[model samples]
Target: MNTIEHRLMELEAKVAFQDETIEILNDEIKVHQQQMAKIKRQTELLAEKLKESQSSQPMMSNMPEPPPPHY
Candidate 1:
C-alpha cells in the first residue's frame, strides 16, 4: 500500500481499538451506578429501622445498677 494509505489504515485501527475500550468502560460505569443505587437504598432502609427501634425503646440511664450477686 502507499504510505498515505498505510498511515490511514493505522489511524483507523487505533480509533477502532479506542472505541471498543470506551464501550467496555461505559458498561462498567453503568453497572457500578446500579450497584451504588442499590446500596444507597439499603442503607436508607437500615437507617429508618434503627430510628424506629430507638424511638420505640425508652431511655433508662437513670435506673440504678443492681448490686453484684457476689455481694
Candidate 2:
C-alpha cells in the first residue's frame, strides 16, 4: 500500500479503538446512574423512617429517674 493509504488505515484503526472505548465508558456511566438513583431513593426512605421513629418516642427528660441500686 502507498504511504498515504497506510497512514489512513492506521488512523482508522485508532478511531475504531477510541469508539469502542467510548461505548464501554458510556455503558458504565448508565449503570452507575441507575445505581445512584436507587441508592438515593433508599436513603430518602430510610430518612423518613428514622423521622417517624424519633417522633413516636417520648422525651426522656419528662420521665422520672429510677432509684439507684442502693434501694
Candidate 3:
C-alpha cells in the first residue's frame, strides 16, 4: 500500500479509540448528574424541615415581663 493509504488507516484507528473513550465519559457524566439531583432533593427537604421547626417554636426571649419600679 502507498504511504498515504497507510497513514489514512492509522488515523481511522485513532478515531475509533477516541469515539469509544467519549462514550464512556458520557455515561460517567450521566451517573454523576443523577447523584447530584438526589443530593439537591435531600437538601431542599432539609431546608423545609428547618423552616417548619423555626416557625413552630415559640421565642422564649421575647416573652412579656413585669415592669420594674425604675420603669
Candidate 4:
C-alpha cells in the first residue's frame, strides 16, 4: 500500500481504540455514580437513626449531683 494509505489506516485504528476506551470508561463512571448514590442514602439513614437514638436517651445535665463520698 502507498505511504499515505498506510498512515490513514493507522490513524483509523487509533481512533477505534480510543472510542472503545471511552465507552468502557463511561460505563465505569455510571457504576461509580450509582454506588455513590447508594452510599449517600445509607449515610443519611445512619445519621437519622443516630439522632433518634440520642433523642430517646435522658440528658445528664438535668440530673442533680449526689452527695460526696466523704459525707
Q: What lDDT does the true structure give each of the candidates?
A: 0.95, 0.97, 0.96, 0.97
Q: Which ten residues in a row have the lowest lDDT in candidate 2?
A: 53-62
Q: lDDT tens digits, residues 1-71, model 4? A: 69999999999999999999999999999999999999999999999999998899987679898989999
The CA-based lDDT of model 2 is what? 0.97
User: For residues 44-68, could you state the per-residue lDDT of candidate 1 as single tens digits?
Assistant: 9999999999888875666787989
Instruction: Name every residue pair that clashes in candidate 1.
Output: none
Model 3 lDDT, residue 13, Cα: 99
| lDDT digits (tens) for residues 1-71 of candidate 3 | 69999999999999999999999999999999999999999999999999999889987668887789898
Using all chains and alpha carbons, the TM-scores for the candidates as numbered come to 0.87, 0.85, 0.78, 0.81
Error of 2 at 31 (Å): 0.3
Error of 4 at 1 (Å): 7.4
Candidate 4 weakest ten by summed lDDT? 58-67
- Give the Cα-based TM-score of candidate 3 against the true structure: 0.78
Model 4 ranges off by over 4 Å: 64-71
Model 3, residue 15: distance off in Å is: 0.8
* Model 2 residue 54 distance off true place after TM-score fit, in angstroms: 0.5
TM-score between model 2 and native: 0.85
Better of 3 and 4 by TM-score: 4
What is the C-alpha RMSD, rounded to one decimal, of candidate 1? 1.6
> Which segments of model 3 are wrong by more than 4 Å?
63-71
